[model samples]
Every structure is written in C-alpha cells, then in structure tokens.
Target chain A: MRVLIMAKEGEKSEAATPPTPEAMAEYQKFNEELVKAGVVLEAGRLYPSSQSKRVQFNGKKRTVIDGPFTETKELVAGYWLWQVRSIDEALEWLKRAPYDGGTFEVREVIEFEGM
Target chain B: MHRAIEAIWRIESARLIAGLARVVGDIGTAEELAQDALVAALEQWPTEGVPERAGAWLMGTAKHRAFDLIRRRKTLDHKHEEIGRSVERAQESVDLDAAIDEEVGDDLLGLIFMACHPVLSKDARVALTLRVLGGLTTEEIARAFLVPVSTISQRIVRAKRTLAEAHVRFEVPGGAERIARLSSVLEVIYLIFNEGYSATAGHDWIRPALCEEALRLGRILAELAPAEPEIHGVVALMEIQASRLVARVGPSGEPVLLLDQDRARWDRLLIRRGLKALERAERLGGALGPYALQAAIAACHARATTASETDWPRIVALYDAVAQLAPSPIVELNRAVAVGMAFGPAAGLELVDALVAEPSLKSYHLLPAVRGDLLRKLGRSEEAGDEFERAASLTENVRERELLERRAAECAAQGTAG
Candidate 1:
C-alpha cells in the first residue's frame, strides 16, 4: 500500500531562514534511509509561504492574497510518497522523521485491490 | 485489470503450487494444474469481472482438477498410479475446508527445499527457484539472467524430470538435513543477487531487477524462517551490499571502489534493515555463520561516517572469523584488504604476497590490484605500475581495465617525477 506522509510546519520550523548544516545533514540522512529502504517513492520540501499565493472563491469572486500568509499553524511543509505495509508502519516512520514538531497526516492512496 | 491480475498471479502462484504439490505428491502435475487454472482465469476473468478472491479462485480451480485426476486414477500408468494413491491418501488426511485455510509457510518452505535440491546443477537450481518461488515466467527469468529463454525452459524441464525420476519427495528434510538444504537455498539466492550486483559496468545497469528479485526472495525466506540466524545473516549481507548500489558505479559506468563511493548516496533504509537483521541473527545466539560474519564486516564499513573513520581493526577481526567459517582464497584476499587498512600498506602487502603463489588466485585481477595499491603506498611506483598493468590484463571488465590502466599510468608518471 502507498501513503502520502505530509508533516505540518511547526511555529519555529519555517524554512524562511536557511537550515543549519547539521539539521540539513540530519534530514538528508533520514531521507536517505527511507529512500534506501525502497520505501520512499517520492519526497520533497515545499517552498515557504513567502513565495506563495492564495486564491479565495466566494460565489466566483476571486480574492487573491500575495506574499507570506500569517496563519502558519498547520500548513504542510513537505510530503513523501512512501510504500509501507500498513498505516502503522508509515506512522512509525513519520514519528522518526527529522521534524522537531509537526502533526503528520498519512493519506492512503486508493488503488485497485492487489495493485 | 490486467496489471492487477499479473500482481495477483505473482503473489499467489507459489502458494498455489506448494499447496498443490503437497496434495498431488508431485510438482510436475501440481504445476500443470496450476497452469490450467491460470489459463481458465485468463479466459473467464475479463468477461466475468475478476473474482473477489482471485487466489482462492485459482486454488479452487486447481483442486477441482486434482479431483478429476483422482477419479481417473484407474487409467494412469504405474508411477502416476502411485501418485494418485498418494493423492487419495492426502485427501483422506486433509479436510477440504481446513486444507484451503492451512498455514502455507511449511508448504512454501518445502517448495524451496525441493527447488534447491542438490541433485540438480547450480544453474538449474537457480532457474527453477526463480521460476517457481518468484512466480516469474521462463521468458522473464531468461531476460533477468541474460540467458536464452529456451535454455531456461530446458533447465526447468530437465530439473523437473530429474526430480520425478529420482523420486524426490516433495517435503522438507528433517534435522541436520534441513540445515544443509537451507544452505543450498541461501547460496542460490545469493548467487542471483551477486549476478545483479556485478552488472555495474554495463550501460543498462541502472536498476538490477535480479537483485530486487533476489532481495524479495531473501526477505520472504527470512520471514518464513525467522528463527534461522543464517537466513537473517544472508538477508542482512545482501541488504547492506544492495544499499551501496546507487553509489557503486560512476556516471560513465566505471566501478567505484567502496572507499571512493559517496556515503550519503548509500541507502540508509537498507543499511538500517541490514543492521536490524544482523542484530536479529546475533540475538538468536550462536557463533555467527559465514554470511553473518561478512555482514558484520560490512556493518563496520557502514557504521563509519567516512573511510578514515572506519574501524579497520574490527573489520579485520570480522574477516578473520569469516576465514575460519569459510576458508577460501577469496576470503583470504578480502581479509588482506582489511588487514592492510588496519596495520599498514606493508602489512597488507605481506598477505597479498602470500596469496600470489596460491594457484587459485594466479589469474585473479583483484589480487594484483590489491598488491598494486600496497606497492603504490610504499612509494614503489615503478613496481606498482607493473602490478597495475598485470591486474588490468587479468581483468575482463572493460571499465575496470580502463580504471586499472589509468592507475598504472599515474604510477608511471609518479615514478618518472621521483
């Protein structure tokens, strides 16, 4: 089965500031482990909200918000498409990730049975 | 839908064969019945809307054929009459409902033992193992191993015929015999993995499907025999070695020496899995087997963040243990490499020098390659260049030869400058 493991960005976990080398190494090491296990099909870090735009729809009235949005409570910071035996296994991997703090969501990808 | 059917067949075919072989008392007939079920599925499934339980559907179809065989027992020849009698006996002992729900691990293990029975040649054992246990078609097996499809088909046919002729029982051996048979299975699996691992010099070396297949087999065996330390040991060893595949070759398809490989590029997940398997083997509590010992040595390299940080002495000690377990010229050569790193180039050169007179290693490229490295370290550039040239001449791999020749040229340039 496949699960998309996305962890929310913490208050201090914003990527606006460059990551320390140690942190980067730690993250890379963790990512490498997942990749080596053949578990990770895809993984990536998202660009910060600073370089993002938001469009709101109210009966087809488009309200655009540009630049950094202040509400950074539980926005997803990164995601990985991981192959795991179960949701518990994916959760276990998520718990061991390099994130200091974040709620991780494991979304099961729907597929035909036996695929 | 077609992909789903392939996936189901891949997962279910082995169990189907194993269960049928146990009931049918022979693998050849078991395979034929299974094939008939598969053929039936192909014809009916697309129109019938694939069954809810595809594997069960296949097994039920096969069992129905087995009953047909039972009814026609009176018309069979002498050998088949015996098989029919055995089937009748098996059916009497096995309740239909429980038989379908039976724990299949034992049957699968039996199938593994039968496939790797020492009566067959190593190539035949390998081909049959892949075909039966891996649920791979003959064409797929041939392509993976780079052999002709006809050859693989012939090997399978010959192997099954031999097993039938020899009256080989479709059951796992007991006690010490089981241990011995298990080793044969491990050796064949490891051989398949190595074939994939060594295909680095080829242009199409990106994903060695054989290695993946071998690993899948190894992982399944480990699960099926969790208490067997050697099983975990071999699994660990393969995982660790496989972890390095991404960094083991250069962009131009040249081999990368272990120390030169990018550590970050090594798969940490595999390393962790290997380490876990090693711990499991050790926890099983016995003197480490040859595979486990080798995994320990690989772990030493894996644990180190860099080449200089590697515990060379620990690796040397592990190699010493491996040499004790499986004393071969190859083990000695690898031990020399570890010894060199632990002591010094001079110390390593001494071990290499000893192996130089050994007949088995006379034409082995790595022996001279190790000798050349030691000589280079000792500042004997002129002699080192000659050794490298000899090593290059002995090697059949084009990329490796080029690398060795380039090393020889560097040594020549150094010799002239000095």
Candidate 2:
C-alpha cells in the first residue's frame, strides 16, 4: 500500500523562523533513510503557507485566495509519498523520523485504473 | 512437431524473453519478439531440423527481431540510439554454441523483479510472473487458479502496459530497494507453492505441477541471491515441504494427515537439499527470519524417523521465534499445535479456545479443525464432532472436507461406543 504522510504544523510557527542548519541536516538524514528503505517515492517540504495559493470553484465562479490563511495547526509543513507493506510498517518507519515535536498523519493513496 | 516446439519453448522462453527484454527495454515487446521467434522455430525446425543449441537459437532470433523493431521505430532518434547500442551489444555476444550462459541467470533475475514489481496489483503480479518467469500459458494459469482465460490474459496485458507506462526499470534494483522488491517476488512464489501444496477448492488434494514450478523458481532465486539468507530460508522451507508431497495424499487422492503420512514415501533427496539450504541460511544470518524459523521447524520434523519421535519441543521453539518475527493468528495456531504436542492436549486446547473470538480465525477452517483434534484427545467427543462438522462446512477443498467429515464421523462413533 502507498501512503501520503503529512507533517502537521506545531506551535513554533515554521513560517516565522527559518530552519537551523542542524535541523536541516537531521531532516536530510531522515530523508536519506526513507530513500534507502525504498519507501519514499517522493518527499518535500512546503515553503510555509505564506507562499501557497488556493482557487475555489463555487458553482463555476472562481474565487481566488492566497495563503498565510489563519489556521496554523491545520497547516501542513511537509509531506512524503511512501510505498509500504502496511500502515503499521509505514508507522514504524515514521516513528523514527528525527523531528523533536510534531505530528504526522498517514493516509493511504488511492490508486485507480491507469494510475 | 508442436509438442517438441512446446518442450523447447518451456525450457527456453523465460531466458529468451528476458534477454529480449534486456535488449528492447520493454517486456511487452520482448514477449512479442520471443513469440515471433517461437513462430519462426515452428516454421523452420520441422523441415530444417531442430538446432543443437535451441535456447541460443531462440535468443538469437528474438534479439534480431528486437533490432528490427528498434529500426522500424526510427521516429524517436534518441530511443533508437539508446536501444540500438544495447541491441548491438546483445548481437555481439549472440553465439549459438554457448546456448545457456551466465548472463541468462542475471537476465532471468531481472525478469523476475520486473514481473513482480509493486506497481502491479497482486493478481496481476502473479499472473504475469507465472506467464513470463514460470513459462506458463494463459490457459494453463487460468486452469490452475480456476479463473477465466480472458481474465488471465487481460491481467497479463494490463500488467505489461502498467510496467511500460510506469517506466519501471528493466534492471534489478540495488541495495534496500532490491530487498523490498525481493519480498514481493518471494511472496508470489510462496503463494504459488501454497496453492499447489494445498489446492483451495479443486478436487485434487495437490497440484504437483505448480509446486514444481514454484520450487524451480525458488531454487533459481537461491542461486541468484545467495547472500540473502531469507532466499535460502524460503528455498529450504519449500524443499522440505515438497519432500512430503508424495506422502500427502492416498492412492485415491484422499487427504493424509502429516503424522499419519508414510515417512518411507518422503523424498529423501529433497529432505537433504532442504537441510543444506537451512544450513546456508544459518551461515549467512544475523538471526533466523520467519522463513528460516519455519524451515527449522520443518527440519526438526524431517530429522525424526517416526511421527512419535519428532522433536516437538524444538519445533515449538522455532514456532515461538517465527511468531516473534512475523506474528499472525495462523502462526499462533500452528504454535498452538506444537505446544499441544510438546505439552499436552489441554494446553493446546487453551490456546485454540483463546483464538475462537479472533475475527480473522472465525472463518478459517484450520482453527476449528485444530480445536476438534484437541477436543477429541480430551475425550470431549460430542464437542469434537461439532468442531469437525464446522471445519468441514468451512473448508472449500473437497478432499479436505471429506477428511474433516470422516473425523466428525469418528468422533460420533467413539461417543456412541463409550
């Protein structure tokens, strides 16, 4: 099964402060582990909600909205696309991520015909 | 003439296609070119006489056809150039005198990885692996699983298309990727072996042909990935289990329990091979993985000259290790059996009863069957008969159902006699 792991935002506000070199190195090591395990098909950090855009279609009327949208806890800092044997296996790998304080939510990727 | 061509195809098709796939970089095209080579063989071999190096003849023909196809698709200059180099390299080494070379092993390994790629669904992987690597026809695969031929054909077609569309590499993956991919390949092989060892719904108790194919694949895998202890472990497990194939069924194809099987009928050669494989696995191991542990359990049984003399405690310990590595209700159930034999019937009964509420084991026939055996030993004949009846009703295999019903009848007779 393939799963998408979303690294949820914490109280520290990733948008306000830049990641330390040490934190970046730690993340790099973790990413390497994921790649080595052949689980992470793709993984990347978002440039904070400040650089995001959302386009909503309300009955064919396009409403454009820009981010730095107020819900900090709901924001996703980064995500990973992983192919693992089971949710438990995915969780086991995720448990070893180097981050000190953050939550990760795993959701199965829906595969369809021709995908 | 057709039979002779089929015999040649069965021996050469996997390597022929693998070599072609390596050259052309597309499994679908590789298969088509290989089929074309087979057609060429049918046309010429009848009159021209079959070549002494028939595998090389097929490979050479397939490679040349691949070269032609590459030339025909000259619209993509870069693809033509890239594939042209590989095709030319293949042509350089195309010596009919050296029919089966070392490179064929690597090519076959690459083909096995490709067929069992995780990009394909489980059913698709099984179908494609059996078709390409196992040298089985769509009809044969269909008949083996009792699925429609059209379904099998469609699965193979779609699997090839998926591999092409997904741009799955033709070469075997390296490092951890290889390990991840190897599990899927091993799983497909084991599934095939298990199906053959115990047919789920068929009238026959066992389909020896599927078992033979799986064993062949496992042996080849052991050769290709000698460093991987789990590969050796799986090979050992299959080899040891296969030794019992001859004794698993009676003259009339009735199911034979393991303890009741005629030990004299077991294949001693296979048992020896199995033990050698187990040793190889142990030599390379950090700790015995699930397969190796199971193989050790099988080895314990094989070492015993008689059923009563079997080392139940050692088997129980191996099962304990297996349960630790790969815990499943099925493993727990098997461990329970070992525990029962090693300790007493009540001990096994306690373990089996604890699993009665397990949702997964509720419909599994073995749970109730094991329960029935324990109950019968404990002199609870009426409950044992009911458990046996439940097991008989749950099982889909005709022969197994008959065995269970017979056990149920025995319980009833014993209860009445008492």
The C-alpha stretches of model 1 lying farther than 4 A from their native spots are A1-115, B74-85, B92-95, B202-207
| Model 2, span B1-418: residue lDDT tens | 6766776676578888888888778889999999999999999999998786676788777777777777666546765576677656656665543543657768888999999999999889988999988778899888888789999999999999999999887898898898889999988888888878775223532255677677778877887778889888898999899888768777777778889999998878679979999999999959988788889999998999999999998888888888888899999999999999999999999998899999998899999999999999999999999999999999988889999999999999999998
For each candidate, the DockQ is 0.05, 0.01
User: Candidate 1's residue-wise lDDT over B1-418, tens digit each?
Assistant: 5655665676578889998888776678889999999889888888897786677789888888887786667466556667667667667744565656455778888898999999989998998998888777898788877779999999999999998898889887889998889999999999989888888744443227677678778877887778899999998999899889878877766788999999998878779989999999999998999899988989988999999999999999988888887899999999898888999999999988999999999899998899999999999999999999999999998989999999999999999999
Q: For model 1, which pairs clash?
A: A33-B269
> Global CA lDDT of candidate 1, please?
0.82
TM-score of chain B of each: 0.96, 0.90
Model 2 Cα displacement at B330 (Å)? 1.2
Per-candidate iRMSD: 12.5, 19.7
Report iRMS (Å) of candidate 1. 12.5
- Using all chains and alpha carbons, the TM-scores for the candidates as numbered come to 0.79, 0.72
